[model samples]
Target: MKNSVFFVLVNILLCACGASANAPSEAEVFSSAHTTPNVLMIVIDDLGWSDVGYNQTTDLLETPNIDALAQQSLSFDNAYAGAANCAPSRAVLMSGQYGPRHGVYTVSPSARGNAKARKLIPIKNQRGLKTQVITMGEALKSAGYATGTFGKWHLGADPDKQGFDKNVAGSHQGMTFHYFSPYNLPNIKDGPKGEYLTDRLTTEVINWIKTPKDSPFFAYLPYYTVHTPLQAPEQVIEKYRKKGIKGEDAKYAAMVELMDTNVGRILTMLQAEGLSDDTLVIFTSDNGGYRTTSFPTPIRAGKGSYYEGGLRVPLLISWPGKIKPGLDHTPVINADFYPTLLTLGKAEQPNQALDGVDLTDLLLNQQAINSRDLFWHFPVYLQAHHARTDQGQDPLFRTRPGSAIRSGDWKLIQYFENNEFELYNLANDLAENNNLASQKPNKVAELKAKLKAWQQQTGADIPTELNPEYDADINQKMIDKILAKKTHH
Candidate 1:
């Protein structure tokens, strides 16, 4: 009888052990997790790294909503836009390729302006994303998720042309004169006169989220605030002016404040809809701040240049219950958004080669990002000339439209214009204040070879011979007109 009791006890212990082994551990669940999270890409126009409250580069600006969102999200401190300007960067974000590859190099003009003027500047062949290539919107749409875009669809003339099912306030134009006016390009559903453009965009987003809680969605809100011809409602302007800000700076600050408030409203809407946990919200700028006086802090140079300030922007991603909060110091680019969003949606990736990697893995798993080169090409430079201001002299000779190849901490800027070169160890010098090309001849040569090799592999289009006789100034008025129509009303 004692022997029988011992056998039964041993069997009971074995059964308990088996049950424990079959149970799922938290780590195991995290490893093979597949949740179809809705994606909200909130793209702020011309916002700098210092503009957001979390980065704290400027006390002149207030972004409480963004700051609160950052607390719950994984913030990328070293994130960069694909290009220094709007169109190219937006193109890169839509298609997981560099600006040079997709052919949308320059910013789009307002729809009402001269088409002949556009031919002269000829947006970097990278302007129009190839129809054959899949966009993030297309991927989500195919997966039964509704895709809607609210503002600044600079990817193409029509969001329908690029795959967005709903495109409100979208246009080919990249700039606007007033946030609210009848001046908007004809296609968008223009709001009432005197309406705040940013506020209208937020209302559209909130309405979309409220109606579509049944399936996943991808809502892209690219605001036209703080770009150029900086205009804001007088009420908002007075609010900031009371704080000692006056003139154009105060108007710019007011626009940013309105943008922040609207963004916060959208976040609040997501929470109210009870979609915060199942949705992923991302806030980033197309490029750096357009204002030269703007502080990018550790980075040097502003928009229209290849400096860190021109490329780097604030990146905040909030995925409740999935992403661990706090800062991610690793470098990320706009191109990564395409692949990362598709991966999160559990959609099939395109067969072609993509320049961006799946950043979600890097953010969640804390895995070391594999060393990969990032490249940029800007052929035409537009030095901004504001009304009657000492806008500074244009460089005597334009640098030959150049290209840069960054691997690890070393970045080599190759000026094809004169075969001139500049190199920096970005690890130590974020401002790019020092040029080490002459000191490190061997490293320069090595990086040059790598850049050339990549150009060959990617089949990058070398600048074709064009007559220097072609003048870009002939269309200035037309370009301005097109830019003005991007606002509200």
Candidate 2:
């Protein structure tokens, strides 16, 4: 015997290298490196970043199924919105933390306009979302997944107390005074007699991704049909009034083409429950859109102005074959979707402080991002929604007690009541109409000491007294009658 055939061929080559190191690597079973993937997340309210058609900036906003899910998805041409409106931008996208680590900077009375036009006296606004902040639906339901959520849980009171095992209408009521039916929301129910509250929350999440689960969910829709009294469904408002689009911009482009046919029926029920390449989805928008029925054109003002049309919008993400479709501009926000869905759901990450940045290698290695410095702080006072077609910061407030910042391609802002700042350069002004803060005073003291050391590392709330019913001649006669009706439009 040749040494018993060399010990049985070295135990069959060590059990085939331990079964190829215990398999599972097609990008680690669709990323998170060992079987963890499924996180829908839609959002869409006050949509803009040029009302989606993959940003051809509006060939009259058709949004063919969110432009076919932004052409397979990776999209992110400078996304942003973690406070520019809608309940502190859904409480900084469910507390990855911002707005001074959760004071919720707006959508409650943080002195919103006319205490003789508020001069300072704000920092109070924490209307909800502070159950000790660990929610990206409770860290993806403690990482085994299977969560729910449906639509618009404007940061409080029953998103099943912030983790969402299932909370269909999702309350704290941000808007749904009537999308149809006595959608008298809260844990939702009534449907049948004139159904259609975004087609019954997209058939109740495609019957909860066709039930019968085995861990891996976190759905979260968040659509309140393109927000506000702009009804639709009269054959999709006569197909946007036959695309000649009329009034209220054809009922908000027929409620964004009926919420893009309920997002192509949950992308055909995640490809009939095969869970579309182990799912990842995303898509976005919680702010910016509602500047008199439609206008994010040239990014000037909308939603509740921190500008760049209320912090731009549309984000996409997809994850079909482990994230790779294309187009990435970087400037992300929305508290970077809770450490980018807890690093794609391999989860477990919340013992506080996560100001956002694990965009999962900017959505799986298209990575080049680098140039950071985002910050937005809104100390309060929002007002001006349609001040003669809102291009605010003038027509009597659309963000007054401020704080901005951008940093690479420089932005600046400031303004906690005329301690003023302004600067611009968003790579040749995306209509911030050039100020360059007195021609860049050392780039405005280097972005005002990096926006004052990020408002002293996010303790932020500095509105300094004053507002003893401050009038200043009725805020300069309503900012000179809305700058003479926005200079005759």
The window of 10 residues in a row where model 2 has the poorest summed lDDT is 26-35
Cα lDDT tens digits for candidate 2, 258-368 = 888789989987877667777888888888887887787787988888878888788888867567677887788989888878977888888999887887875765557
lDDT of 1 by residue, 100-164 (tens): 56666555431112333322232244445667777878877877788889878766668876778
The lDDT per prediction is 0.73, 0.81
Model 1 bad stretches (over 4 Å): 1-32, 108-127, 384-400, 464-489
- Kindly give the number of clashing pairs for every candidate: 8, 0
Off by over 4 Å in 2: 1-35, 45-91, 102-246, 276-285, 288-291, 294-302, 305-344, 348-377, 380-383, 387-395, 398-458, 465-471, 476-489
Residue 125's C-alpha lDDT in candidate 1? 47
